[model samples]
Target chain A: MIRLVPRSDTPALLQVATPVMAVLATMIAGGILFAIMGYDPVAAIKTIFWDPLFGLAASYSRPQLLVKAAPLILIASGLAVGFRAGIWNIGAEGQYIIGAITGAAVALAAYPAPEMWIFPAMVIAGAAGGWAWGMIPALLRNWFGASEILVSLMLVYVAQRIAAWMAFGPMRNPEGFGMPGSRNLQQYPAASNPELIAGTGAHWGVVAAAAAVLATWFLMSRHIRGFHIRAAGTAPRAARFAGVRPETLVAFCLGLSGALAGMAGLFEVAGPAGQITDKVGVGYGFTAIIVAFLGRLHPVGILLAGLLLALTYIGGELAQLTMNLPAATVQVFQGMLLFFLLGFDLLTRYRIARRVTA
Target chain B: MIDPIALFLLLLSASTPILFAALGELVVERAGVLNLGVEGMMIMGALSGFATAHYSGNAFLGFAAAALAGALVALPFAILTQFLMSNQVASGLALTLFGLGLAALFGKPVEGVKAPTMAAGPLGLNWIVWLGLAMVPAIWWFLNRSRAGLILRGVGENHDAAHALGYDVRQVRLAAIAFGGAMAGVGGAFISIATVLQWTEGMTAGAGWIALAIVVFSNWTAPGVLAGAWLFGGVTVLQLRLQAAGVRVPVQLLSMAPYLATIIVLVAISARQKFSRRAGGAAPGSLGQDFHALR
Candidate 1:
């Protein structure tokens, strides 16, 4: 019988190695899945993992990696903080939507204004909108014994509905013939989140994502509040005794994550998405949760994980075009990667033994 | 105007999916495991049941397949949390993503195909609906009066003590997870087979989540779950009725009622627990805590 013994100490290197192993395992398992689906597994795998960067369409896909990774990394950076503090805010998708709406409201209201301050103002509104939405769960949890996980998750549906309402009722483009979407921000130069350089796909959101990683790294590893968060997660009672306020930590974590997610949403609407629609959320908020976990909840790790996941998005699209694979194949691949990563995390916590021995 | 009895039957049909799911989740939570993959399992069940029923032209067989698929899909979560000691929350979320993606992938071929009509049971209600109603009393009886149920409760309440008393915590939790998955699956199948009558991507929507909220609202009781399901079902039915009547109320806002209601209920119950003396009264002792028998 197989038995597991708890390790006295988990090696840092082993933790890093585990994700790589999980990736390899997912490739093998995903290949099997593809084979069963009657596709050339090797070609499918190559298309997904290698083709985005090396395939014939690499030129277009390379820039897209940044465009996709930006939101995921930005959102995950904030989520990692909350996760570290034992707070769960699973409604980033909702926050992102609300943020986009609020951020775009500023631009839409200032229709013909060529003022340089409009975009900055929109950014503020976006962050504020996200903060307000995130604060709902934080306040409820602080006031009551409510589960933030359920509360936050419920809000996602609520947010989706709100996005739908806005798209159909208020934000419907007047110029378009009864289309259920906002005015295209892409066409509005002042409002648009344009690329900073020629073809690199580097927008303000991408820059902000890189900044979030650095800020989070410093906060978690340097700041005393970060120490409090770590302490609260590991030993709640001890952290309380040491004067760390649970409510404050809860608010800080939720608000920070919410704000970051909102910014991500704002950038998306102004850049790649270009308009608010019923389908605005697009699962980026949900996928970022996987990114956080995949990154081992570390800032640097999250950067790499974001890029890897972005690769899947681009590669999944490429696969759809080149190999005629179902779009869900990428989703399945993402899900499988997370499953394997979580399963293999067992190795870091315990040692497997063939026969029992003290 | 909608007839009173007709409205009641509509409510019953509407509530059945969530009822099945909430009841299954109740058993799981009572057994001290929090499996958040109800949404995933239900979607899997929906797809599998719809596909099976579509192919075989037998709706009954579709429900059966859903139950089986749900159980099979839940095994990996059980192993990860029960044996591997992974975080239950993360694993459960991953399970949902996996199920949704897999279902969407496989559901492509079955999309737009209408389900064969299932033979109606007594009183013109679907058999699955009646079965869902019957499960209420049955689960209450099992949880309150049965010997195996009591042992399962003990394992959930105190795994270490239960292990000392020679009970297997892992086995009990595993069984509970599978049952939960199966129930959720059937509930999901009800949507595709009986209600929607066709397969659609992400059609289960947030029914699984609403089910989770109901488990909390039920205080982990079967009859309580029934009441919560009816309340949600009633809201949904009324909302649909209002829509049909061509009221000026925005459909999107109307549809958001159930989710907002869930949030309100969760907040109210949690506040009561926080302010009342009976803190941690209804929740199982070992809920969300992984159990490992030390050597």
Candidate 2:
């Protein structure tokens, strides 16, 4: 029997190679899973991974990559900042929903009026809405000593309900004869998040996501506040010794993440989603957590990881249409990625070894 | 009219899942390990139990399958966190995500298919509900009276001391984790078979998370878990009743009451714990920390 021996030091090569290895392992496992399901594993894999970028149907799917990746990257970027500081704010989904509703509230209030400031006002409302929602957990944790994870996650169900209420009641479009959705923002150019470029799917959300990447990279690497965040996560006692306030860091991280998630929600509503609906939040907030982990919680890495996940989303949809796979197959695939990443993450801290018992 | 009998029965049924999961987790925590993957394990159990029962038309077999499935899913978590020394928080999160995904995948085909309805016995309650009620006392006895339970608690309170006394800390922990997984599995099975009676994607709907919080809110006690579960169940049943009554509130908002109640309960309990420094006030000494033996 092989026994694992702990190593004293981790190598640089192993740090980079583990994620790559995990991906390969997942691919093999996925192929086997497909075979078991009586599907052509190789062709199915191609449809999911290869066809989205290089295959004949790449034209339509290519633009979708950006559309999907934009929100994921935006949300993940914010989540990563909080995660790095060990402030577990798991309710970005709730924030996202509230942001969409708040943002759309602004747009709907200004319907039929083509004003330049309407869209900008909607974006601000979305960000502020998310920030306010996030502050609830942060304040509770600070004041009453509540677990942010439980509080934040619980809020998600509440937010979903609120969104449902808005879509079915207050925000329901008057002219649409009682549908459970608001007026499409696409029809109102003033509040719409139209593409900056005509056909490439490059919209303001993508721009904001890119800007967030750069801004977070700078904040984490250069700013003193960032140092405090990192120090707090690595060692709370030491950070306290260095005059870092734990409660302040918790609020900041939670607030920043909430705002970023809200921005992603706003962009989505104003762009791809195009209206406030019962399904406005989707699962982007939850999926963004995976993206944050997959990116290893680094800003630059988050950008690349976001694109890769976006590719999977496009590919999953394409695979569903072309290969007759179920819609949830993508969720499973993404879940597999997280499992493999986590499983392989062990290599970073501990090395496996063979041992002999005397 | 308040129908106290119906209310009591609903509360009992709701508390079953929480009791099973909390008791299991209580065992695991007593072994000095905090497994946050309870949600994932429960979801796996839900899907597996539903699938097995749907296919075989045996609710008993379905519950057994769920327990086995939950234990199987938890094995890797034990290996990675215990042997490989991976971060417990990260591993737990991954487990939840993976479990949710895998359940959705496997449950896709099983969607809309009804499981074999659990027959109401002479008592007018399903067998699983009775079993859940029975488990409360059994769990209390196991944790408070059993030798294995004492050893488990000893390890949780102080692993190094337990190790010095020649107890296999790792082995004890593994057993506790497996036991926890099995109990959580039964809870999930209860949801699918006794409650929902149908397989739907993501049907557990944060019940696992609520159970996790209940364990904390209960201050890691069996009776407390039962009370918390009943409280949540009351909220859930009341919401359903309100919806049935066609109350002015939206159904969506009504459905959210339980989750909100959970958060409120968690916050209240946490505050009480902070203020009171009694024996049961503090969390377990070695919670969420991985043990590394230096020989």
Candidate 3:
């Protein structure tokens, strides 16, 4: 029998190699899954992993990579901050919805206006909306000792309902013959989150995603608060003894993550998604959780992980269009990636040893 | 006017899935493991059950398939967390993500397919509903009276002490997690085969999370889970009634009932747990911590 011997320190080489190993394992596993579904496994794997970036449709799909990656990177970066402090804000989806609603509300209320301040003001509203939504769990945990995980998750359903209400009722486009969506923000230039350089998918959201990656990297590595956050997650009692207030940490982590997720929503609404529809949330928030883990909860790692996941999204779409694969295959593939990552992560903290038979 | 009996029946049906899932979670928690992938497992069950029922023309077989699927999905989680000593919370989340994805993938072929009709067992309720009701006392006995149950609880209360006492802590928790997965799967299958009578992506729709909250609301007791499930079911039934009655409130707001009710219930139960510290049964001592059997 083999026994796992706990390592005194996490192996640095394994720390880096595990994510890479997880991806390779997922590829092999995912390939087998495709083969079981009767598709040519190699072609399907190539379609999902290669075609999006370098296939015949690379020109079209490459740009979408950034568009898809933006929300993921933004949300994962925010979530990573909280994850570092052992604060789980799983309701970024809710925050994303509320942020889109609030931000779009600003644009709709100031419709067809040529004001410069409208977009910036909408951004603030979006962030604030998300921040407030995140506070529900934080405050509940702080005041009543509720589990943030359940509270935040429960809030996602409520946010979805609220988003539906907004689209079906209050934000319904009047000029579109009773359609259940807001006016396309893309048409509204002052509020649009358009690509700075056409065909590159380099919109304000992408820029913000980059900014988030940098800022989080700086925060985690260089700041005292970052030190506190890391300390709290690793050693809660010690953190408390060192004067790190648990409530404040929870509130801050949740709030920051909420704000980032909300901004991602706002950007998507104004850019690629182009409207506040009932279906505006398409699981970016949940996917971001996978991105955070895939990246090993590191900011730079998250950037690469987000891009990798985005490749799967673009490739998944291509696979659906070309091979008649179901759209859900992408979601399944991502789920496998996270599962493999967690499984492989075991190697970092422990070594398998052969038990000596007496 | 809506008949009270119809409303009660609807409440029972609506609550059945959550009740089943929560009961399973109650056992898992009682054995000191917190599995958050109830939603994922439930969805896997929903998909597999529907697909099986559609192909075999047998609902019972579908449910059995679902239970097996759920347990199979959860096996990875048990292996990763219990044996490999991975983070329980992260592993559980991965299980959920994987389950949802795998379910959707499996459910693709069954989309738009109609489920076989299920006959009522007693009191105009389905057999699963009755099973859910029966599970309360059955589980209560298993946890409170049975010797194996005591060993499970001992493992949960303190693994180190349990280890000293010669109990297989990893094996006990693995059994509990697998049972939880099977229960969650059955609860999920209940949604597809009975309640919705159709296969749809994400049909479980946060029922798993609500069940998680219910487990906590029950303070990890079988009876508490039943009451919590009923309360949620009542809210779900009332919300649908309000929609049918065309009350002035928006349908979206009405749809928020169960989720809002969950939060409220969580807060209330947490406060109660805080106030009555000596009452015990708050949470398992090692609920989310990964256990490693060191030599």
For model 2, residues B1-295, the per-residue Cα lDDT tens digits are: 8798977787778777767887788778767788878888898999999899989999999999999998888887898678777667767767777788788878877888888977786458778778877777787887789998788788888888888898998999899889889989989988888888887777778887888888888787777777887888888888888999999988888888998899889889888886776744656677778787764
Off by over 4 Å in 3: B279-281
Give the C-alpha miss distance for residue B236 in model 1, angstroms: 0.4
Worst 10 residues of 2 chain A by lDDT: A1-10
* Top candidate by lDDT: 1
- Residue range A193-218, candidate 2, lDDT tens digits: 99888768899999999999999999
Q: Calculate each model's fnat, 2 decimals.
A: 0.80, 0.59, 0.81
Model 1, range B128-233, lDDT digits (tens) per residue? Answer: 9999999999999999999999998998889899999998889999999999999999999999999999999999998998999899888889999999999999
TM-score of 3: 0.98
Ranking by TM-score: 1, 3, 2
Cα TM-score of candidate 1: 0.99
Models 1 onward score TM values of 0.99, 0.96, 0.98
lDDT of 1: 0.93
lDDT of 1 by residue, A1-358 (tens): 8888889888988999999999999999999999999999999999998998998988988999999999999999999999998899989999999999999999988987888998898888899988899999999999987899899999999999999999999988888799899999988888889999978999999999999999999999999999999999989999999999999999999999999999999999999999999998999999999999899999999999999999999989998998899999988998888899999999998988786555
**Candidate 2 docking class:** medium
* Candidate 1 error regions (>4 Å): none
